[model samples]
Target: MLIFIILALIITILVIKKSKTKLQKTLNETVSNLNKTIREKDDIISELSKYQDIIDVQSKCDELLSNAQNEAELIKKRYETLLTFAQIEAEKIKEKSLSAKKQMDEQIKIRKVEYDNILSTALEQSKQIISDANIKAEEIAGDAYKALNNHKELEQKAKAMKNVIEGYGNKYIIPTHGILDELADDFGYAEAGIELKKSRQKSKFMVENGLAAKCDYVENNRKTTAINFVTDAFNGKVDTILSTVKSTNYGVLKQKITDSYILVNNLGEAFRNAVITPEYLQARLDELKWAVAAFELKEKEKEEQRLIKEQIREEERARRDYEKAIKEAAKEEEMLKKLMAKAQLQLQEANDQQKAEYESKLIDLQKKLQEAEEKNQRALSMAQQTKSGHVYIISNVGSFGEDVYKIGMTRRLDPLDRVKELGDASVPFTFDVHSMIFSDDAPKLETELHKIFNKNQVNKVNPKKEFFKVNIKDVKSQIEKMGIQSKWTMLAEAKEYRESLAIENEMKSSEEFAS
Candidate 1:
């Protein structure tokens, strides 16, 4: 940009210089030619004067020449001054051009530097932006790959599972001290439940497979394992496991077992005893595996006992706090606090009472268990009197018409005794007692059999009694409701009917006294 301006100024100076030179040359040529032409003309005028009135003519010619020379001189002086002014103006123009040219060059240099800086900055930013984009893209791709890998891992795990997905944590296939029944329920089907129970039994309280194999008691343990838990039991060191299931070396696990006593705490004792109970099928249980369950149960029981004591202390403190609150109530305006305290005391007392009731219920349950034990003992003793024969089913329970029958399981437990315990009297003897059709889970079998048999369908034993089934639990629930009536007093007519005219005599006596 500055170069173009400088070129324009130089061109203007050259044009002005050339025009001044041409004007000067033309003026000089014109002046010289005029002087020569005047000289010749002057000679001619002088000669003509000499011919006629020569003297007079020559004098006039000389005067005229003098006048012309004076005019020419004045013109020359004016031209010279004009020429000088022109030269001075040209010099001024040149000086202005040189100053403008210098300024233009400086601006050009500054603009070039700025443009280069801008270009360099833009290049640097572009490189940085590209680098950042590439890094971010790579990170995203890596994350996507990781996600895909995780998904594949999950898919593989799912494929590896033989049956039910153990979405619930599978620390152990079936832990020791844990009930097999609970695990079975989680698996969602009866057969699976049976397998879960079988797993629990195999583990006993849970031990390494090799350790379990060492014991004669667990020789027939049917559980197959992805990881063995019985190897520690063989070495007699189940508490500190530092070795694998297949290895015979008693390292970490052995150390742990030796250091950790099995039967020190109440929970430990409970679980140890549970592993040996016949109900859990201890005879067939892998004692080595049961150790794991025992450990867990012991921990849980310890926590439960600790919480129970804490709650008891809290309740006692609350009760004591309330008892003292009445004394503070005197000479006080805030009856509300006292009232609230009293209410709190009552609530605490009630809670204590509820806890007592629960404990009582536990006692009752214990008593019931004892009774059950006695009954079982009696039944065992009466095994001699027991006979495999037909039993009667002649009665039904409740008004919500359903097939609730009196099912007698052989002749071991008297039908009358069973009926009475069920809170009902047995019906009068009717028809013949039929032959035993089938026997499985008797309670469940009975309910299903009755559902199939339908109403007035006595002595009619169906072949598909085994296949046709009802939930015994549901039947038992219904039966339970029938045997007890919470609102017996609400039925006015039934109440009156049961008592007959006992109210009439009392009414008559009150009326007579009034008269």
Candidate 2:
């Protein structure tokens, strides 16, 4: 029985030991959980502190907003008061302006009435002054006419007496029937008495029957007046003719001369009794003819001078071209010779397969060298021949219109260069070449073409202008007649002009659509 009790005590001690271990573990777990709870509570406190700081900032913002609201309300009230005062002042100013405007309108009406009255009086005075002046002018004109008539009568009598003195002897006496017989019988008495009595009888006869003397005076007056009138008219006409010659074109001058001749002849014929003698009329016509001849000679001389200057300029240009061509040809020939030499050297060192290529290349270089030399020789020949050049027919349809062409000549190696220069900035579009004819006598060919189309020249007054208005067919026919063969381009391709017309039409269409 004591053994069983000792065993029970040992079992009890074991149970107590296990239970105490579990209790100690539970205490440790509780302490760990409490520490974790304290840490979570510290985190919550930190978050709450941050939220408190935000709340404080929000309160400060609220105070600032309230202050701003109060100030805005005060400003709004002050502006309303100012607006009310301004409205009251504006109403007063409008009332005063309306009253002032009414007063000004009344003053303007009174001033306008005074102005009209003054204008009416001035107009009446002006009309009276003009009428009186016209009456005085008529009286003066009538007096002048009377004075002129009296002067003409005196001049007629003087001219008649002068003519009578010139036709007969100044000292010759009139022959009376009985006076001569009486003088033969009583020489001394008859000479004195017969002279007195014959003078009285002559005066009496002139007073009674003066038809012959009156006719002579009238004829003399008519001739003198006609001569004076024609002289003045001729002088005036000559001055006018000279002015016209200077101002008018040469083409119109001949017509002007014909008109003036007819007018002057008609003036001469208008006079009565053959007063303008045929001899005098013919002499005046001869003077006019001489004057016109002199003017024509002067113009011809000027034209010749211009032509000579132009010819000199053309010759100089040709000479320059020739020199340039010779220099260029010499340069090309020298370059070709160097290339041939280099090719020959490469040919000598080439391999069999490469030798064939080099040989072909050498042959090409040799040919080029020969061509260059030939070109140089040709240039020299052309330079030596003064007439060697190219004659070209070209047209600028945009500037000069259709069927008009310029026939020109150039000594340049590339005749197209001259054509390009002719189609420069002076014209809106470039010229289209119709034909380029190379000739040894280019000037002669050009001259022949010009003569054939002389009447068709665009500017007949200036022959230096080479443009002609003729169809391509006519030109070709004339060229064939001159025994020249040429390729002709009958159609002109006015590319830019056509394009401009297209663009213009498109723009007009767009404008019309927009409108």
lDDT of 1 at 457: 43
TM-score per model over all chains: 0.18, 0.49
The residue-level lDDT of candidate 2 at 288 comes to 37
For candidate 2, report its TM-score.
Answer: 0.49
Clashes of 2: 0
Provide the lDDT at 188 for model 1: 30
Model 2 C-alpha lDDT per residue in residues 172-283, reported as the tens digit of each score: 3222222223333333432444444554354344334421111122576775666556545644654565465444443333334334434444456566522323333344
- Candidate 2: minimum summed lDDT over ten consecutive residues — where? 208-217
| Model 1 C-alpha lDDT per residue in residues 1-515, reported as the tens digit of each score | 88999999999999999999999999999999999999999999987876777777799999999999999999999999999999999999999999999999999999999999999999999999988976787688977755665685445444334212432233223322234334433333344434436665555543433323321232244322211323323223332232232322222233233222222211222222211122222322333333333333444456667866864654344344333333332223244344445555555667655656555544554555455445544444433332322233423222112333334443323344333343333432221221232232344545554564454343332322122123334434544454521111111122222343467777899999999
Q: By TM-score, how accurate is candidate 1?
A: 0.18
lDDT, residue 393, model 2 = 93
Q: Which stretches of candidate 2 lie over 4 Å from their true place?
A: 1-237, 249-285, 352-357, 460-464, 481-483
